[model samples]
Target: MDNNCLFCRIVAGEIPATVVHETDTTLAFRDIDPKAPVHVLVIPKEHHADVVTLAQNDPAGSADLLAACAVVAETEGLLMEGFRLLFNTGAYAGQEVFHVHAHVLGGEPLGPMLAPR
Candidate 1:
């Protein structure tokens, strides 16, 4: 775990978050800043700086992260209307929070907007 990461703190119970889905491997919580009617951040319990870092640390976990998107969709009731999953890899990619997270966003038409720039 990264000693100074915000998500690590949240996972370790040092900080509070509105959690929706949680298991031994991951945790899904409401994003503090929501871009949609239903915006959730699906994060790994284990700490890694970003998706690149996560891939290097545990490639299997990286794949698991993607697979976890299904759970997020089912839980959030976005399976029918469709949902978008996004990962902001680096600073230039708009990854403000260094911790690796998947944005499971949906609940509206959202149009043709890209997930993240």
Candidate 2:
């Protein structure tokens, strides 16, 4: 785990977080800033700058991350209602935290993928 990474800290129990689900390899927690009624952040316990890095460096962990997201969706009762999974990779993508994580959003109509263009 990267000492400076926020998610790593959360996983390590160094930082406080509203953890909703956890497994041997993954951690799912409520987002501090919620975009929807259900906004959970799923992440691997291990450190990875982004999803691409996680996929390239630890494929199994990457898969675990995805699995964790699914578990969170089902547990949160958003599976049948539908939910959106998002990964912000870099600065332009609004990835404020460098640690790789997936945002599971649901609980209401999310509208378009982006604002009117």
Candidate 2: TM-score?
0.96
- Give the clash count for model 2: 0
Which pairs clash (backbone N, Cα, C closer than 3 Å) in model 2?
none
lDDT of 1 by residue, 1-117 (tens): 776999999999999999998877888999998999889998888988898898998998887887777888898899999988889988888999898999999999877765677
Query: Model 2 RMSD to the real structure?
Result: 0.9
C-alpha TM-score for every candidate: 0.90, 0.96
Overall lDDT per candidate, in order of appearance? 0.89, 0.93
lDDT by residue (1-70, candidate 2, tens digit) is: 8998888999999999998999999999999999999999999888889999999999999889999999
Question: How much does each candidate deviate from the true structure in C-alpha RMSD?
Answer: 2.3, 0.9
